[model samples]
Target: MNAKIIIVLVSVVAAAGAIATFYSQAHAPLERVTEGFETGYGGWAPDADVPIDPNTGQPVDWYVARSTDVSFSGTHSLKFFIDGRQDDGTIWIERKVLLREGARRVNITFDLYSGEESFNTIAVVCAYAGFKDPEHEGELTVLGPANEVAGWKRYSLAVDIDTGNAQEAWVAAGISVRWETHMTYYLDDIIIEVT
Candidate 1:
C-alpha cells in the first residue's frame, strides 16, 4: 500500500509539471511584427502626405530614411525629418499585419530619440487594429509624447483586440510625431508581440 501511494503521488506531480510547462509555452509571448526596424525600416511606409508630391501631384508623405548615427541596438534605425511648414500636418510610419485567431492582445514597443532635448511635445508611439472586410471596425491606441533626452527612450502600448468576431484582423504599429513640431525623431528596435 505504501509503494502504491508513492507511485501515485509521483505520477500526479509529474503530470502537473508537464501541464504547467505546456501552458507556459502556449502562452509565451509571440512576436507579431514580421519585420521590425532591425532590418531597415521593416517594410513600414509613410502615408497621408500633407504637401503635394510636386512630381506626382499627390500629397507627399514625410521623408523617411535609415540612419546609423543613433540606434537602440544593431546598426540601423529609422529617421523621420519634418519641417513645421506644411498646412495639413500628419506624419507617421505604419505597417499592416494580418493577425491570426485567438490573438488576445498586442504589445507594441520601440526605442525613440529626439534631436532637441528641450521642446514642446513632439513624438509618440502608436498602434492600430482594423477589420479587413468592414474596414472601420477596429481600435487605435497611441502612447507617449517621448520626453527622453540625449539617449534612447523605450515606449510601448498593449492594445486589446476584439477577437470574438473571428474574422481576419489587421494590426498596424509605428512611431509618429506631432506635425509642425519641426524636429528630428529617431526610432529603432520596434517590436510588436501578441498573446
Candidate 2:
C-alpha cells in the first residue's frame, strides 16, 4: 500500500482500539462492593433463613436461603450457611451492579469467617446467573475454601467469560457458601474488578 494509505489504516486501528478500551472500562471499573442485599436487619445469626447481614445490607454470600424470615442471631458479624448433607437453604440477594458487558475480566473476592472450632472449606462461590440457575447447572463458577482458622482472609478468583465469540457476552456472577448442613459461615466485602 502507499504511505498515505498506511497512515490512514494505522489511524483507524488506533481509534478503534481506544474506543474498545473505553467501552470495556466504562462497564466494569474496579472496586469492592456489596453489589446488592436487604437493608434493615443489622447483622447475621446462625441457621437463620435470612442469611444476609441486615446491618451491612448485603445479600448472603451463598445460595438464596430457603426463606427470608430465617435469621442469624450471634457471631457479631456477617455470616453464610448451608443445609447439612440434606443440603438446602439459600439467600437470594438481587444484583446491584451488573458486570459491565465489556468487562475485560473480573476477580470475585471476599473475607469469610467461621465461629466453629474446625470447619470444612467454605466456598466464596461465584455463580454467573446465581438465583436464575438452579443446581448451578450451566453456570461458570469460582470457589474459595474457608476451612482454615476462620477469621478474615482475602480470597479471590479471576475469570474471563468465553462468550463463544458472540457479539454480546458476560459471565453471570454471584457468590455462594456451601457446607455440611447446619454449618455456620460469614462473609464480608465481596468485590468485582476489571484490570
Candidate 3:
C-alpha cells in the first residue's frame, strides 16, 4: 500500500466519524419539560377535588408530599397519597404549557415505587398520563396499571402533539384507585423531551 493512500484513508475515516458525531448531537431531542419532580412538585398543581374518606370520616384531598425515604434518582421524591374513599377517584398533578407549533412529538419518562408485592386489592393501581392539547384534541400516550412492588422502576410514554391546531398542552400524572382503597405511591425524576 502506498503511504499517501493510507493517509487519505485515515483522513476519510476521521472525517466520517466527526460528521456522525455532529449529526447525532445536533438532532438530539430538546427539553420541553413539564416537571422533573426533582424539586418539590416542579410546578405541578393539584386538579382533583378533596373527598371525605368514608373510612376515616375526614376530608382528604389528593395529597402530594416530599418523601426522603425513597427516590428514583435523587435524595427526595414526591409521594402521592390516594384517599381510601373508594369512589373511583384519581388524584392528578398537572402543569399547563404552550406547545411549539409544527409537527412535534413529546416523550415523558418517570420513576415510580410501590410498597406492595402486587396490587391485590380491587383499588390497587398505577397510572400515568402524558401531555395533551385541549384545542387540538390530540391523543395522549398513557402508561399504567403496573403492579410492580418493592423497588424503583422507570416508566415512559411517547406521543405526537398536534401543534398545528394546538398551542397549549397539559402534562399530568395520577393514581386512580377504586373506592375503599388506600395507598401511597412514589414518583420522581420526571422528564419531558420534545423533537
Candidate 4:
C-alpha cells in the first residue's frame, strides 16, 4: 500500500511539472523591439509637417479623414476604421533592432474582421538596420499587393539578411490605401514575431 501511494504521488508531480513547462513555453513573451522608433500620423492636416505622398497621396504621418482615428503607444495599439481598406493616418509604433546573417523568420500578424476580399492597399515591411546612423544599412522589404487577402490573414516573411556592418533594424511597415478608397475596414492586434 505504501509503495503504491508513493508511485502515484511521483507521477502526479511529474505530470504537473511537464504541463507547467509547456504552458510557459507557449505563452512566453516575444523579444521587445529596439528603442526610440515611433509610429507617425498627421491627423488630416494639409499643413502638417509630414506631407502626403505625391504618388499615393496617403499621409506620411497620422492624418485621418472625418470620423477616423488611429494611435499606438507601447504594446497597446489601436486603429479605428471607417472603410473597407485601411486608410492613411493609422500606424503602430516602430523600433530598430539587429538581425545577424542567417535564416531569419519574421512573423507579421494582425487581425481583421470576417468580410469580402476588398482590401485594395499595398502593405510594405521595410526594415533598416543601423537606422540610428542609417549609413550602416541593413534590409528593406516590400511585402505585398495581395489580392485574395481577406477575412483575417497572417503573413510570415522569411528573409536572409547577410552578415555585415549592418547592425540595426528599423521597420516602416504600413498599409497604403489610395484615393477614393472606401469600405469599412478594421485592423488590430499587430504583432512582430521573430524566430
Candidate 5:
C-alpha cells in the first residue's frame, strides 16, 4: 500500500510539471525584434506604389530613407515622402521575421511622428503582417489617420496566420495618401513579436 501511494504521488507530480511546461511554452513569445533606425534600416527596405507620371510613364516620386529630422526615441528615424498630387499612393518599409513552425500570431507596434495635426486627413497609417510579403497597397490594413497627433504617436497591429511549415513571415508599416498634396512622415521604434 505504501509503495502504491508513493507511485501515485510521483505520477501526480510529473503531470503537474508537464502541465507547467506546456503552459509556459504556449504563452511565451517565439521571437521578437525591435528597430530604432539608429544604426541603419535594420533589415527593412522601402517599397511604394504610385500613379504613373503622364510624361515619364513611370510611377510618381516616392522616397524612403533614414533621417535625423525627427524621431520618437532614438536620434534617427525613417522618412517617407510621397507625391499625393493625384491623391493616390502608398509607401511603406517592410522586413521578414522568423517564426516557429506552427500556427502563430504576430503583434507589431511602432511610433509615427507627424509635423502637425489636422482634421483633414492627409494620409492614413497602415500595417501588415502575414505569411507573404505585401506587394500592393491593397494588401495593407489601415490602422488609423496618420495626422491624428502633432508629434509622436503609437500604433499597433496584430495578425493571426497559419505558418504551417513556413519559417518566415513578413511585416510592414507606412502610410497611404488621401488628400491631394505632397506629404512627409516619419516612423521609429518598431517592435515585432511572434507568439
Candidate 6:
C-alpha cells in the first residue's frame, strides 16, 4: 500500500509541473516598442501620394519633416503637408519593425494633432500593419477623421498576421485628403506591441 501511494503522489507532482511549464509558455509576455519622435524619426520614413500637375506631369507639392510647432508629448513631432487642391492625396510615415519568429499579432497606437475640431472632414486618419510595405493609399486602412479633436487625439489599429516564418512587419500611420484644400497635421507618441 505504501509503495502504491508513493507512486500516485509522484505521478501527480510530475503532472502539475508539466502543466505549469505549458501555461507559462502559452502565456509569454508581449514585446513592445515606442517612438515619440523627440530625438528623431526613429527609423520611420515618410511617403505620400498626390495627383500630377498637368503642365509638368510631376506630382504636386507634399512635405514631411520634424517640427517643433506642435507635439503630443515631446517638444518635437512629425509634420505632414500636402496640397489637396485636387481633393485627392495621402501622406504617411512608415517603418519596418523586427518581430519574434512566431509573432502572430501586432497592435499600433499613436496620437495626431490637428489645428481645430470640426464636423467637416478635411482628412481621415489612417494606419497599416502587414508584411509588405504599403505602396498606395488603398493599402492603408482609415481609422477615423483627423479633425475630430482640436488639439491631439489617439488612434489604434491591430492586425493578425501569419508571422510563423516572417521576421519583420511594416507599420505606418498618416492621413488621407477628403476635401479639396491644403492640409497639415502632426503625429507623435507611437507605440507598437507584438505577440
Highest TM-score: which candidate?
A: 5
Please give the CA lDDT of all the candidate structures: 0.62, 0.44, 0.63, 0.39, 0.93, 0.90
Top model by lDDT, which number?
5
Model 6, span 73-93: residue lDDT tens? 869999989988888989999
- List, residue by residue over 1-195, the lDDT tens digit for candidate 4: 699999999999999999999998655533333221124331111111123556677644342222223222233223323232333322322445455444244444444322355454433222222234222112233344423454544433443344346555444333333433343333434455543
lDDT of 2 at 138: 28
- Model 6 CA lDDT for position 16: 100
Alpha carbon deviation, residue 2, candidate 5 (Å) = 20
lDDT tens digits, residues 1-195, model 3? 999999999999999999999998667764467454556677777555346666678766568777787887758888878665556555656676556545377666777777765655433333333344222112222355534557766877767766767666666655666546667777788777766
Better of 1 and 2 by TM-score: 1
Q: Please report, as a residue range, the 10-residue window in candidate 3 with the lowest summed lDDT.
A: 133-142
Q: Rank the candidates by lDDT, best first.
A: 5, 6, 3, 1, 2, 4
Candidate 4 local lDDT, residue 52? 56
In model 3, residue pairs whose N, Cα or C atoms come closer than 3 Å (at least 3 residues apart or on different chains), thus clashing, are 86-179, 86-180, 87-179
Kindly list the per-residue Cα lDDT of model 5 for residues 100-155, writing each as its tens digit: 86647999999998899999999999999987889899999999999999999999
Report how far off residue 16 is in candidate 2 (Å): 23
Off by over 4 Å in 3: 1-22, 34-38, 49-60, 119-142
Off by over 4 Å in 2: 1-78, 87-96, 99-102, 117-142, 162-181
Model 3 CA lDDT for position 160: 70
Could you tell me every candidate's TM-score relative to the true structure?
0.73, 0.46, 0.70, 0.40, 0.86, 0.84
**Model 4 Cα displacement at 35 (Å)?**
14
lDDT of 5 at 141: 96
